[model samples]
Each structure stands twice: as C-alpha cells, then as structure tokens.
Target: MIAWRAGAAYPPAGPFVPVAGGRLATLQAGPERNARGTVVLIHGASANAADPMEGVGRLLAARGFRVIAFDRPGHGWSDRLGAATPAAQADRIAEALGSLDPGPVIVLGHSWGGAAALALALDHPERVSGLVLVAPVALPFPQRVALPWYWRLAAQPPVAWLLSRTLGPPLALYYLRGASAQAFRPQPPSEGYLERARVPLAVRPGALLSNVEDLIGLPAALERQSPRYGSLSVPVLIVSGDADPLVRIEAQAEPLAKRIPGARLLRLPGLGHMVPWVAGDRLAEAVADFLPEAASTR
Candidate 1:
C-alpha cells in the first residue's frame, strides 16, 4: 500500500489533492486509520460531484468505507473548462486513483458519471476493484420523434442556438424539475433542493455547451466501445430504476448486463433515475454486499 501524508493546508473534512495531469478536489470522512477501502463517487451532467454523491458518501462512510467525492472537470472547482469527453474524464480519474495507496477501491458513478466510470474500467481495469452504477445512462436509446414538429425543427443548428441562448437556464431548470418529478413519484423535490441546485445551474457558464457536446459525442463513443463490455474482468453491480424516463432500462442496463460476464443487475420497480438521492442508503447497502471481502471486512 502507498501512503502519502495529508498536507496541512488540506481540509480535514475534504482534502484537495493535485494529480499529475489534473487536480482531484476530494471530500472524505471516515476513520483516520484502518480504513476499509476507498470509494470514489462520481456525479452526472450539469451537476457537480458534491450535489449527487455527498449524501451517499456520508452514508457509505458510516458503514466503514472511506468515501471520496470529487467534482468532475468543467462542472465544479476543478474548472479547466473545455471538452470534457468521457474518455478524458476517465483518464483523469485514473490519475487520481494513482495518488492513493493501493487497496480494494470501488468506483461508484451516477448517470453520465456511470458512463465515465465504465470508460475508466475499460481503460484501466487494474485501478478498480468493483463498480456500482446508479441509474446509469449506458447506451443511446431511441430518440423520441413524437414531439411537435416545431420542437424537432428547433433542435437543428442556428434555431436551436437562438432558443438555447435565449432560454437555456430556464429550460435547464425546467428539465431538472421534470426529471425530478418523473423519477421521484408521490414525493416531489422540495423548493429548497431545487433552489440550491439552481445555484450550480446559474453559476456554471459552460454547462449548456458542455452538455450539448457530451450528447453529441457520447453516441459515437458508446458505439465504438459497446462491444468491449465482455472483456471487463472486474466485478460490476448495475442498479437502475424502472421509472427512469431519461434512461431506458432495456436499451441501457439489461443489454449491458447481458454483455458483461458476471455483472449483477438490480432493478427498482418504482424508483426513478435519482436512485442515489432517493434510495442512497439502500443502494449503498446493495453495493456493500458486492464489495470484495478484503475491502468489505475492514
């Protein structure tokens, strides 16, 4: 195991470590000594790492795993904004893992972050001991063409630009609310949660452009790499909500599970895409079950 002393300047609660290629802004809480293993939590598009995984991190830490949550590039404090392709993001995570002492480390990702984690596992399998995918958007599902003709027309170039520039923030907020509503039935998000999320939505200047680029580039990336899932040697646990509107279970989770050898799948009957937020403790418990004996025992 590799041990690097924490710098005095680093936060006792959340430490910021500089990786060789890029910095990984991480928040960790757990036993100072005899930590079982590290669990790196990755978040989704338009949202930073802290927003989605913080609660889950706290829960996991309580269960004895050293949980580290970091902001993905272009989304949070590590704002080296440009094209944040899945492959590039994965490479950065690989570098961050290098800084830590070798142990059984689990990579847990939500939504787009799940795709990023998958990329990491594909590119650097040795760095990950296991994977927990929460409502992962794994494959490119069929696009909905039933919307109004004008909506489709607006999705094209300059018109889309005009609409995006004019109402992007509001539209983003609307979509966020819509996602929350569709994913979490019976109990909608509180005003405070949405309001707090608005801060990140409002402050992120490059979010719209980055999201568009991510959508444009992701399909090709998945097409290129989908066939290689069978080659992954690491243990994988896939969790998804049947009610998730954004990611189709058939197109994403089921197919990917079939391709990957020994991959376990857990489908929540009425749960939505926000599984990590809505069912975090339950998800963590499920993940804890899959962890290797060396890591889980500690």
Candidate 2:
C-alpha cells in the first residue's frame, strides 16, 4: 500500500497500528522509558497525524514525554471503520491505544478533534488522563449558522459517493489553499505548513468525503454529547484564540471551560483558529505545566 503521505516524496512519519475494522497511522516520538506520560494528538477536520505531529508532538517529545499523533479514523492513512461520529471515532482510537498498551494518556485535541477528545474522556475514561483542547469545537454554537448549500449536499451518502468519485477531489484541491488561508485568518500559517503537515493528503477523494461528513455531522453530535461534559473527571485545559473566526471562543471554549468542572481556559488575544501551528511552543509549555497536576489525579 502507498504511504500515508500519499504522493509526497518523503516517507510516512510513523507506522500503521492495528485497530478494530482496520489500522490507524500513527506518528510517535520521545523516549519510551521514564517518560512523563503519553500524550495523544488528535487533529481537526481535513487533517492527518502530521498536523498535530508538526504542531506540538515533537516539542512534547523533546520534553521527555511519549507523544503519539493518530490519523483519526478516516482522515489520514487510517481506515474509515464506519466511524460516523466523534464517539465512534473515539472508540476506534481507544482500541488502538489498547493494542499499544499505553496506560492512561494526556490527549491534546484541536478543533473538531477537540470533540473527539471529549468523547474519549467521557466514554473511554480509562484511556485519557487529561485533556488539552486548542481552539476546540466541543459544544454547539450559541446561534444557528446555516451551512453552505454544497456542504449540505455533500453530507448525503448517495451524493457524497458520486461527488467523491467525480467532483470532490478537484473541488477540494481547488479550495484547499483558500480554506487553509481562511482557517488561519488573522494569522499567517506557519512556514511550509502544507508540506510539513501533509495537508494535500486530505484532498484525496475518500478523505475529502470524510471531512465533509465529519463537519456536517458535528453539530448534532455535539448537541447529543455536550450535556454529558459535566461528568468528565480528568483535568482539562482549554487554550483558545479569542479572535478565532471558525470556532468562536465565546461560543465554544468559554462555555466548555465552564461546563467541565475545574477546567481552565486560556484565551490568547489576536490569534485565530490555527493555534497549534502559530503557538505550539506556548501550548507545549502549558502541557508541561498542566501535566503534573493531571498526573496527581492518578
């Protein structure tokens, strides 16, 4: 099989690990022995293991933590495995972690992946010791924002199948650069982000379809899952950019911090949705500081 980087000249960052329906691609870093703790990185929509790996995985690894960034279910090199919701995706990730036999871990999830992290912490509590949510979309927005017509259309399975084979790839390729720019609006993307993050892999027909499915399905999933946030027992740190246009801080992070008891919210001024890329060092520092407290609970 082709590597997770798809057509990129370089090799895949890590190996594929077996899970339920299929395998997941994972990029691992740091020493295996005497590590601070395992930190799992989950990327948002239209991203792969490389996104968070490049964002903060290496930095955490360098700090004496074992870090693993997974291609969430269908996103990167991972098999789709019928993970249609964040909860389902979390189960799949939990299975992978079980096989790897890593004890309870600290999970850092960005954007939509934040929802997945919340699911992991709630449904598979034993798998996650703590959470670092960056620009997360864990709760339903305060106001209803209508989705674009194309997004709604793409959400349908029949249309999605046809479009994935016919129009999706080209359309995704056409919009990829603009979308990345918009996602990082008010803050330029870190240099060489596309290549380093293997972003082009996301535009492949299947991955693009999965992205639309994940995005369109998110709101309802959050509505169903949000009410359960109060039960999470792990230490949670929410880092968000107040100026984020995609996932608003007031609507998502601020409310989430309050919903989860003892959760801490750190709002960064003048920043945007791409917090992991633009402010990875700060995030690493936050993780380093929060980990001790997280470990204390265990």
Candidate 3:
C-alpha cells in the first residue's frame, strides 16, 4: 500500500510495453507511422518520462517527429530490474526500442539519463542514429565527494526497505517542491511543472532504492564507460548551460565533446541544469537543425 501510494500518487501518462528484464512505461506523441523520424527520451534520477514529455517531447511531436519518452527502469510506473548501472538500463531500453520501432531513432537524455544514452550508443549503436544530451552527468566527480549520511545509511538493503515503507515517501514529498525549484536555479521552473512532471513517483520505496543505488553506483560505471567515448561513431550533440551548478559544464559536456570525434557542443550562456524544461524552444530549434543530418545517416 505504501509503495502504491508513493509511486502511483499520479497515474501513468501512457501505456506499458513488455521488454527484456521487465516492462517499461512510455509516453508517446506524434504519428505512429510516416513520421520524419522517432525521438526517444530517457529521463534522469527523480524523474519520469513526463519530465521530457511535458518539456520537449510534445513540442517535437507537434513538429511531426514521433516523440516517445520512457520512465527509466525503477522510476515512475516502470518496474525495477536491479538496473542501477547505465549499461543495464541501456540494455532494457534498447530491447524495448528494438521491439517497438522499425528503424534507428534519435535518443535524447537529460541529467543522469545522459550516461544511459552514451551506454546505448556504445553497446547498441544500431538502435541510435543520433544523441542529444542535456546537462548530462557523463563523467565522474573530479574529487572524491562524500556521500550524505542518510544516503549511506539507506544504502543498506533492509534499511532502505524499512525507510521506504515508513519515512521515505513523506520526507521525499516534504522536499519535492524545493528540489524542483532548485533545478531551475537562476530561472524559475516552468508553470505547473510539479503537476506535469509527476515527480512524486520518485518517493516510492522501490523507486527510492533504485535511485539511491544508481547514484551510489554511477561513479564506478562512468569510470568503466568514459574511456569508450572516443570510439563513438554516431552524431552527438551535447547541450549544456554555462551556469549549471549541479553538473558543471567544464567537467561533463565540454570534455565529453572533446573526446567524441566531430561532436557538437552548444553552450547556453544563462541557462541552468533544467535546460530541456526552460529552453524548449531553443532546444527544438537545435534538434530541428540537427535532425536532417541525423536522419541522413540512418
């Protein structure tokens, strides 16, 4: 009941599709057939498919591109499959893509989802014709950052299960508004973002456990994955805000672009971490410009 209340606080925006590992929930817009191309959206930690669906997915759909956003494994209405690593998440998402779409699709990932996007490109290159990574956490922290005490405690399996049923949802709800507000630092969050994004789904016991595990396990995954960026052959477009305090541009996007041969980097002067939400118009324009090239390659 607690898991139901916390994760299902808001109903899923779309349907579920069976895939390897488990099922995935997805929100799609645009024509199912005869569209210019398909765009697959992978959201980050503490977010569901609605985060990008409400931001850029619908906009791209209206522009005649098929836009589909997935609730990453263990997030929103999707099942948790012990998918803490990007490669594992990438495999699950790739399986769904293979079953659903007939051709390669443009994959766009935001924040933590960026790592999964890169993983997909590296492991399942045939599934991705191009990549759009926004404020992505592509590299390990330059310094050994200490984990929060609560996070460390919660990392214990039994403790996480206990907290999830008891205090996790309530505590997560208490800070939801503030965290949402902080994501758009320097720029206010879009109107009705909290309602539209369905962020409360992150509070569920299973989702919380998956999210914590993802965070704790990400550095090691990046260490193993970052070395392969130079080998990527797909068209890569990385968009980041110069003022993003959460994922510094210097550490992630800038260097990532340097590593990938022929990758394009767009640095928005005054933007923050929530680029897709606040800069949808600009983002759409960039995607529109790049689509022809991305499509041509497929």
Ranking 1 against 2 by TM-score, winner: 2
What is the C-alpha local distance difference test score of each model?
A: 0.67, 0.88, 0.88
Which number leads on TM-score? 3
Give the range of the ten consecutive residues with the poorest summed lDDT in model 2. 1-10
- Model 3 local distance difference test score: 0.88
Give the lDDT of residue 183 in candidate 2: 89
Task: After the best TM-score superposition of candidate 3, give how far the Cα of residue 266 lies from its true spot, in angstroms.
Answer: 0.5
What's the distance in Å from true for residue 17, model 2?
Answer: 1.4
Q: Runs in model 2 with CA error above 4 Å?
A: 1-11, 142-146
lDDT of 1 by residue, 1-298 (tens): 0001111221223566676545766666666567667788888766665555454777788888788776776555554435367777788777777876545478898888888888888898777888888877666543343234555555566766665566665566557667656545534654455443332342233445555556555666776767787888888899988877767677688887888888889998877677776777888898778777325323
For model 1, the superposed segments whose C-alpha errors exceed 4 Å read 1-13, 20-22, 81-83, 142-167, 170-179, 182-187, 190-192, 195-203, 293-298
Give the CA lDDT, 0 to 100, for residue 172 in model 2: 73
| lDDT-best of 1 and 3 | 3
Q: How accurate is candidate 1 locally (lDDT)?
A: 0.67
Please report the TM-score between candidate 1 and the true structure. 0.79
